[model samples]
Target: MVTFIEKGFLYGFILGLSLGFFIVPYKEVFPMGEGVTETTYLNLVDFIIPLIRVGVITAVIGGLVGFFFYRKKIRAYNNK
Candidate 1:
């Protein structure tokens, strides 16, 4: 049980951190607004802040999902 939760958090953290590379702030993932006509590069703080924010959010979500998914297995193991 503990191991499963730990693994979930660990994997989630890693996955979230890596996601930063693919996703960024105001990325217009589901764009329905006007198209961009300009471009600009992000500074260190600008880029990093989003990464950290996304990382933490994803990590928590990942941990929770893992816990729920493995809850049954954990109970079964304890019964044994």
Candidate 2:
């Protein structure tokens, strides 16, 4: 589970970097709206993107790993 979480974090980091570099601009991928200035936009790219990525990926991977393990254990128990 921990390993899966760590891998997810790493993957999220890569994803965030790519998002910040390309998709985030033009308010397309995750729009901050028209009121946001360039400074705020840059700040978001630096801060918000990683935070969002980490959170999303951590939850997703942790849940998936936990579910798989739980199901496996249940199956094993049922077999016996």
Candidate 3:
């Protein structure tokens, strides 16, 4: 159970960091001629912060799921 939780956390952290890398290149582009000036910029901090937050949430959920499955398996084994 502890191992599952640790693995879940590691996986989640890696996935989140990779996603952040992908998001780093994102740029919001505003088209001109719509009564608005064209603008493009990357908000690295904003994007990364959310990715980290989601990653942590995912890690917790994954850990809980692993724990639940482990418990279920143990129960089934004992019943047999």
Candidate 4:
């Protein structure tokens, strides 16, 4: 069984990536929509980069919150 803190990080990483994991360039028309046409291309980012960035932020937060809640549960269990 995974610890609550670990599960927190895991769930957070998945949720964060699912939220905004893509970088899609928008089609931009410039110069009063007259001759300049900007081509929009889909940029494929390596899964590692966002995972690391997002994991560092949201996962840590989740782990801390999980730790806090877990401690509360433990205390309740012990008192019972």
Candidate 5:
């Protein structure tokens, strides 16, 4: 159970970082509506902040999913 949560966190972190890398490069192509400044450009901090936020959120969701599936498997096995 704990192991699943840990793995979820690790995997989610990696996944988020990968997504950030892919998205940051094409950020300029995505229109942000007028009035935005160049400061909104995909900088290191901007990329990293979303990476961490998404990673943490994904981790929690993943952990819950893992826990649910694990429990389901165990219940099925015991039913036999």
Candidate 6:
């Protein structure tokens, strides 16, 4: 089974990307007014770079947290 930290990171990454790519873009999604053009969404490729960076960073941090907790538990068990 995946540890809680791994699960939390996976959920966080998916949730973060979904909101970043979909919900956040709506900030600039105004209707085109007279003689004005609507802002364009970031290109898929452009979004991927930041998306991957966020995902990797989240995963690594989560793994480290999990490792720390695992080590703590091991030490506690050994001391018992």
lDDT of each: 0.78, 0.58, 0.73, 0.67, 0.68, 0.65
TM-score of each: 0.68, 0.41, 0.67, 0.62, 0.63, 0.58
**Which candidate wins on lDDT?**
1
Instruction: Give the Cα error of residue 76 in candidate 5, in Å.
Output: 1.4
Each candidate's number of clashing pairs is 0, 0, 0, 0, 0, 0
- Model 5, 1-80: lDDT tens digits are 67766776677667766666665452554445796544345777766776677667766777777777778888999999
Q: Supply the global lDDT for candidate 5.
A: 0.68
RMSD of each: 5.0, 7.1, 3.2, 4.0, 4.7, 4.6
Clashing pairs in 2: none
Candidate 4 Cα deviation (angstroms), residue 34:
4.8
Local error of candidate 6 at residue 75 (angstroms): 1.0
Off by over 4 Å in 5: 23-40
On residues 49-73, what C-alpha lDDT tens digit does candidate 1 reach at each position? 8898888888888888888879877
Q: What does candidate 4's lDDT look like per residue over 7-48, in tens digits?
A: 888877776666535532223344547576666543345555
Per-residue lDDT value at 76 in model 5: 95
**Weakest ten-residue segment in model 6 by summed lDDT:** 19-28
Which ranges in model 6 have alpha carbons more than 4 Å from their true place? 1-37
Model 1 deviation from native, Cα RMSD in Å? 5.0
- Expressed as tens digits, the lDDT of each residue in 1-80 for candidate 6 is 24756775676576566655553342245577887777767777777777776666666666666667777887899999
Q: For candidate 5, which ten residues in a row score worst on lDDT?
A: 23-32
Off by over 4 Å in 3: 19-25, 34-39
Candidate 6 pairs with clashing backbones: none
For candidate 1, the 10 contiguous residues with the lowest summed lDDT are 24-33
